[model samples]
Target: MTHPALIPGIGVEDTPRVFSTNWAVFGIAGVLVLGVVVWGFLAPDSISAAGAASLGWVTDNFGWLFSLLAIATIGFMFVVGYGRTGGIRLGADDESPEFSTVSWIAMLFSAGMGIGLLFWGPAEPLAYFTDVPPGFTAEPGSRDAMLDALAQSILHWGPMAWAFYALVGGAIAYAAYRRGRAPLISAIFRPIFGERTEGWIGAVIDVFAIIVTLFGTGVTLGMGTLQIASGVEVVTGIGPLGNAGLIVIITILTAAFVVSAVSGIKRGIRALSNINMVIAAVIGVFIFIAGPTLFLLNMIPASVSAFFGELWTMLLRNPAQGNDAAAFMASWTNYYWAWWISWTPFVGMFIAKISRGRTLREFVTVVIVVPSIVCIVWFGIMGGTTMLFESQGSGIADAGSPEAILFAVFGALPFGVVLSVLAMISIILFFVTSADSAAIVMGSMSQRGKPEPSTWVTITWGVLLGAAALALLLAGG
Candidate 1:
């Protein structure tokens, strides 16, 4: 029955009021902007150079280590589910009308999917189709090519990937709800160290998780925002907004997300999630029915078969020769694993918060299966359509990147202008939801299990993320 520590002199209920102070939030925002400006002027080259160096180090030394660690973490969840006391149960007794099955599903999908689906769905399949990774290949635009693309994308977003998040989420949820512990990464070590996780060790873990999450999720937010900006450029035929446009977009979006987050999970996160899901479904349906429907239908079975046939080999394959396979592994697989790991802290925490009332089995199924399925379908429809179009020799070149593929696919559709507009809007909302969720997680981390961090802390993280993204963008330049 331990409750969140209250601010001195403030009633427990009044904590939210203190936490929501506009002045503090704005001040933090100012610091964030100032940091970004300083970085822009003084260390522009260092930003991208550092990112490249860091990425190189991870790929060269720690790529396999991350994969193995991720696998081990997943294994731990099954042990916990089977051996732990009380097994897994649904819903907390204290909360009013805990997240319903539907709401839970929506929140998970929105938070997990982000804008990656919109950007990667079409391009990744096409990448696999053309180059094919080390373990699998098919003639460009051939039936096999299309299937291979879908299969690989699914494999990337499949059980193992979702399991990574589920393990972390399960660990956090178990510690917080089952053990009456705080929601922090240190809780994962409680089984090993007991109360020793409470002092400096816990603080270090919390801080590490916060910093990693900030950078990782910030990279994602930047990527999503860039996509939105690109989508805007595509639809409106506007000149590049350069770095200034990126800052403006981030500022406006951050404000919207903060408000949604402050409104609490029910009214804000839930509502926005449902709306985003509906929009996503509508977009998927449009692609399925209007784009190469028959081709897409045929591709699924073939892809599933190919994926199964190559699953093990693909997972284990690491090309020693410096060729397409190596590039694919480095660019796609390695980068994705890092991104997922980076995202675990924020997404895992958010998932744990909403997953309070579910069994271990239910949590695993929903968190891993539902979102993975959504990713597969999304890639199938969008990616499948891109292959169909490219095969027909429609003068549509392979979109060098995932972001490019989204614009290409949407541009080819009937009422292309309208659909692209709506898609852009949806991307903005999706980015906000993601940024807000990360902000909340970072806020919680800063406060060390305080349900919500001070407004200043939340805003500070938001601005820093935005600044980091700007640095990455400048580094690319």
Candidate 2:
């Protein structure tokens, strides 16, 4: 066996400066993406119908699998992190983290769940509060409802979600740094495929990763665009901008992220993520202070407790709970599980890139625990405040759309327009950071895990990502 140190792309000096392209993977993914674009444009209604049906079928039939997979991932991470492998480093034992703890965390939070938290923080809890899921008896506007809502929100965005990312990210990092394999998803399967990992099997795996990343990114970009569009209408006093407007916004943001992606990870991704974290913190603090301060403080712990107390119930929910429970799962929990799984490829790869030199335990702790706490706090504040508003008849729940709920909550506070504007900026920045990271991951995968994929390759992936998002938007979403 070749020693890990002698691998082709093992170190900075030995790494190839060129693209070292995997044309098979790149070409196949490109063709498939192009087909999606053409289908989306030529038959948008059909695309929408097909997408809805596919999502429905998966959520209804395979939701149990999603739920089972999520909990199992969490348990697997715990066992792996604390077991004998806990002390093993992702890189050389003497190596240190490439980025500071704060920066690394900011990137992880940003790429893994930034836009999602921004878009869903207030909306989801309020949603659950308005209509409690089956098997829960909390009154719509009661304190119990508020706690349950927050708990459910945490369930979706917290540990169960991040575990997927940590598992995939840890596997990729181990394969690349410890085993001296290329960083491709295929490389991780080498234990099974052996030498065939370098053949069609490897190309197939990489291509699958690219497609998943592309569409996963498209789903997230779509959310950001919708929220931004809603914000634009709120700030400008303009009417709804329809699908055409969504496409235009998608184009602009896509261009921005493409530029950022080509600027390299250390410079563009890190800087924007750190700055965005600061801005997000400012926004969060402002909301906590300007909203019901005491209620938020009280709800934070209450919600965290509620989440843990009910964690198993939420995790084990399935069709057996009855039709209503199954329906709820299809719409919410199951859907989120599937979304997170779809996203692990890109988010996991990004986490792996910045997470070298950490022990398995350390990596798991940071990736799962830290982000889960962030989500819990974020919901406790944003969702808790929104619930407070609704209970007081502020009508925040009537915000017409989930994307507009945060702005509606802002409208009830001082400096409403100012908050809305800042919220818009934050969403756009999060959108860019996530997209840039996805682009880099796709580029790296296409080039057989080159650490620094060629700039044009990154650009190509970015443009394709935008195209995929645009197609979804044009298909009525």
Q: Compared with the true structure, what per-residue lDDT tens digits does model 2 show for residues 1-477?
A: 965433322322233434489999999999999899889989999999999999988886787789889878999999888987788788766778889999999999889988999899999999899999876778888999999999999989998899999999999988777666777788779989899998999889889999999998898898999999999999999999988789789989999999999998999999999999999998899999988999999999999889888877787777888998888999899889889999998998899999988888999999999999888888899999999999999999888799999899999999999999999999999999999999999999999898888998999999999998888877887
- In model 1, what is the error at residue 367, expressed in angstroms? 0.7
lDDT of 1: 0.71
Every candidate's lDDT: 0.71, 0.89
In TM-score terms, which candidate is top? 2
Q: What is candidate 1's lDDT per residue for 1-477, written digit by digit as tens?
A: 533221111212322322232333234434554655467558877766766787887787876776676567656655655454223453343333278888888888677766777767777887777766676556666777677778878877766677778888877876676556677887789878878776667666776677677677666777777787777788879987777888788778877887876766778888988888888888889878878788778776677677788777667766474566666777778777788888888888989888876776677667876776677767778878887887777534554546666887777888777778878877877887887787777777666566666776666666666666666565563
Clashes by residue pair, model 1: 90-357, 91-357
TM-score of every model? 0.87, 0.96
As a whole number from 0 to 100, the lDDT of residue 82 in candidate 1 is 49
Q: Pick the candidate with the highest lDDT.
A: 2
Q: What clash count does candidate 1 reach?
A: 2
Cand. 2 Cα-lDDT: 0.89
